[model samples]
Target chain A: MSRESVVGTAEHAAESEWGRLSSRLILVNLAILVAPVVMFLADLAITGDAGLQALITLGSLFVTFLVVSGIGLMRLFTTRYRVTEHSVELHSGLLFRSRRSIPVDRIRSVDLTANPVHRLFGLTTLSIGTGEQSTSASHRLALDGISKADAVELRRRLIEARDARRGYAVPVEDDGPISELDWSWLRYGPLSVWGVGGVLIAGASVYRTLHELKVDPLKWGFVKDLEHRFGSVPLWYGILASVVVLVVLGIAGSTATFIESWSGYRLTREEGGMFRVRRGLLVTRSVSIEQQRLRGVELVEPIPLRWARAAKLNAVASGLGSLDDNRKRRMLTPPVPRAEARRVAAEVLGTDRSLVLRTGLTRHPRAALRRRVNRALMWTVLITAVPVGLGLWLGPGLVRGGLIGGAVLLLVLVAFAVDAYRTLGHGMRGRYLLTSSGTFAHRTVALRQEGIIGWKITRTPFQRRAGLFTLGATTAAGEGVYKVHDVTDAQGIALAEQAVPRLLLPFLERDPRSAARG
Target chain B: MEDVRLRPPRHRVESRAVNWWRLQSLLFAVPLPLTFGILWASIPPTRQIFMWLTLGFLVPGLIYVLVMPPWRYRVHRWEVTDEAVYAASGWLWQQWRVVPLSRVQTVDTLRGPLQQIFKLSGVTVTTASASGAVKIKGIDHAMADDLVAHLTRFTQATPEDAT
Candidate 1:
């Protein structure tokens, strides 16, 4: 059928009409393409250069704008989508002519995103995720810009259709949002690695940009004055002052980012068994995931957050899209009080209490502790050797420095190793298999037992000698594989078999005497 | 303290796999010493140390070439049953993987140039999870084809989402 005829018939039938994108997309495209051209023209006007060089640059800029805007305009005109009984179909491309049809049942997620520009025009971009593993662009189906109301309505219809087809009970309307933004949660904002990391990244980018522009920041009057002041101060005092300054800056930067990204965060369970997360101040995002796809939940407590008794929650779900998208959408709650995080986790998983909060986890064998300490010792020696070697080649001053650093490092590493060993544990709780580990960022992942698809056991020569192995439970959700590290070989095998019964039982051998006695 | 509960998988890979691994290791080990020798002969400044460097690289490289292939052959094994496919690989860092037949998504036979020279092939069984792919390497080419067929038939019989 011709495109025009299809649209005509659909409009007459009042059924499935070929939906066109928001006309505002053309303005968005033009604005993006023209901004740089406008800047270049402004630069040209200020320089008062009207020579042939200027003429060529202006002409080239115009042609580039024409080509880009032409493509954008063509895309805007050709792109059309419609939801049929079985599939969501998208047709686009003027010259090449492409058509894509994703089965309604396979649609895993429907996400709506609106940046500042899109928000200005009351439009949002909709991405329909099919849960395909391939990272190719063809597998991604997105409608660039549509009215916000329309996007939300379309998301509801698509998700509802899938639920209805699957014979799931589709709620008529969303209940009150399960979780909403709390201003007091800002206390945990600066207690994240991102605080220091954000400051470093911003500083580095600023330095690079200044260098690229051929400007020396050190030449600035204030910077030179500060350097002179610092030179007079004692070395230790100057170091302390700098550390204080960096910490303050890092706190400010992280808090600002936290507010900007999560000002009005809301997690709501919509009518069609979909959990929707809506957040962001400037660039708003509304990500929806089918409840059926959720396999479990993960409670993450990074060292800094753990010190503050704060934690974050993430959903372990399938069909959330590529790895990057999956990570962005998996966030169930920002850093909050550990108790609040546990509450939200339980609410999201539709349970009374968070599974990870349960006690009596099966701790790893003492051999695992020995393994960790051995690893820590090996790392300490390897790292200390670098400085020691440099000291030998250089001077006695470096030798003193290396010895001091090595002592401090050994102390820290040994503590970390002990802490890591203490944190290692795995256990079965009802239908979920809980594995908790890591010293840097303790992650307590509660994965549904049935979600486990396969098992991978790895043992190094040292681990084999120690009678320990790392067991990874592979699933289609979240991180794909969650590992329980440094368990005894017997413990690892028993855990795997218990987690997924029939899957590994056939492959395992039992003692003939024990079998006969049983 | 090997666990008596879990035995090694049933079948060893093709015996000729030792030669293929030896050739593969040789390809990796031969170049460094040869390069050092050439540099030592061509460059005057490198003469003092290059001879020692060549020996340092050559001695260990040759020993590794001699030892690794046979050790790897002893370590590598695979088995397929009605319910699951099991594989054990690697020498120093050993791995054992098991994927149920119901979760098998794709079964492919891979033959690299070295493998083709020895008429050996590898069977890769992929599951839904990204990290759940299991490879049975260094099998007879014809046997690999038969294994793939067997796995495919078994997988097709059990209909599930695999996720």
Candidate 2:
């Protein structure tokens, strides 16, 4: 009866928004406000004339209704989105007149999320993300309040458009939905450092929020309860006790978060060569990536996870998602057994190249080992000296702690350095190049040599003096550049030559004895 | 045992590009300290410290700007081959990079105002690499065009490979 009465104008080239949604939005919002509104009305009736209060209430509501209806009208008729042959163009804003278009070829993923309110109205919010844009604009192109049918249709059309551009046979086949989150995997959640980190972050945020609100957390009911439970403890003991409590809480919080995120996880390899993942307990997320977009796979083993013989598998794809944002949907497997991860990676890639990471890893030269050792020693010295200096500056109370801490840290660093060296290996099995390295989080990458676009050879003054150079393989996929460090110049060039043959051959001199010089 | 020496690249950037870089460095280095010097001179307590700091930054900076152009000219080298484009550059430590003819997505040439004055041009070869686009600066105008033309021909001939 209201805003849907308005028809789309000629200037509105794209189709109009769905259903206005005024009835739904108003009903939901009004229902939420009803309790407070009723309380206010009762108070007004008690304080003033009942009839006048009712009249005022009706007047205000009529005004709210008019305003909401106007907005719904403008939104219904003015806002528009269209799937053109080549692009998804969205136009909104009445006065400013904004138009944004994402080319169909560039659309990497379209994720749909619908809350309870949206589900009631059969609506979904679409997040259209493109892989290659330098700005956050690529991640946040959301189309809100679209019909579920239209959303499905739009995704199909966009996929079709991409297929047309790519000249690939498109199949809508959905295959065996394998691999759900195992309750046993819950063991890995508590083992992760991310749990402790999440706890610390939550505490910091809560502390900040309390400060912003000008509320003293110490005087709060929980703190009082904690204090009562602990009794009047001494200062140092109080600190230690709180620290232990916080750590336990953090572990619990992190474990809960992991379960929530990974529960009901399912992976499906469809007939059309797309790997679709549907996961999440509270907010269900569906991600489908075509096999054509995948470049390689990475096996990441954080030190603790490694200790447990567990690893996480991530797909090295153009626009799978951002790691900085902790979008671990890119991860093929959670912290599972290393062997299990390998199997999962093999299944996901659907190729024999997945086996390349496990075997035939050629170790880097002795010079690389020396470099790591020296670097580790240098860092140990530098880091220890700071604490030593601080102890000296702050007087003698901290000297023993500083010295012990420094020694322990140095020991850890030394072990880490040796592990890093142990991890340093690269292998080439035909077109596939396998490289694995790291200290805390060892990563093994299996990439295609043909995928390499360029070679960047760099030698620091120190590296040059040591006759060593690093060769970074550049590609459009993954983190962009994968580096092989501290190799002899001959080895580096030889590696590059093998990676992309004629490209480096034209530049390298025939002689191999030339050592790098600063 | 075969011995290898640093074989110089086939083409060197225009000598004037050195001056342009120095000029560019000067453009960057001069204003901030000059503004800070004026601000420091306006206040009495900070004047000596400001003078000392400005001298500290500018003296070495001016020396660096002047010396770097020619020293950079000494090191800057590039060669465009039938198979790839190679650029050898850097200051303390050098890097020699190779971007094959097949991988280059776009070849863009820019002529900044100072570059125009120096009769120099810069070419950037953007490939589909995460390391990002490679830039070769201080080419003579004709050479830039010739390089671009050659790259265009190669790019057109092999669109099937790298992308």
Model 2, span B1-163: residue lDDT tens:
1243235577888888888989988987787678767867798888888888778777877887887778778878899887788887876777777888887888999999999999999899987665767778898999999999999999888884333
The list of candidate 2 runs beyond 4 A from truth reads: A1-108, A113-123, A128-142, A147-150, A156-175, A210-214, A221-236, A319-329, A353-359, A393-401, A512-518, B1-8, B27-71, B161-163
lDDT of 1 by residue, A1-518 (tens): 22221222233434348787888887877666565466555545555455565556657767887888788788888998888666677788898777777777888889988898889889898999877654543467888888888898888778777777777866546568889999999998887678777888899987774444334578777899999999999999999998899999989988887887788999998876788888899888888877877889999999989999999989998877766767888998889888988888788787757578735789999998988888888898898888888989998788888888888998999999999988899988888888999979999999888788888889899988987889999888888889999887667877887788877776667646456776
Candidate 2 residue pairs in clash (backbone atoms < 3 Å): none
- Residue pairs that clash (backbone atoms under 3 angstroms), model 1: none
| Alpha carbon deviation, residue A157, candidate 1 (Å) | 2.1
Interface RMSD after interface superposition, each candidate: 3.8, 3.6
TM-score of chain B, candidate 2?
A: 0.87
Q: Which candidate is the best by DockQ?
A: 1
lDDT of all predictions, in order shown? 0.83, 0.71
Candidate number achieving the greatest TM-score relative to the actual structure: 1
Tens digit per residue, CA lDDT, model 2, A305-374? 8899888887776664443422444766667888778877777766653563644677777777778878
> By TM-score, how accurate is candidate 1?
0.91
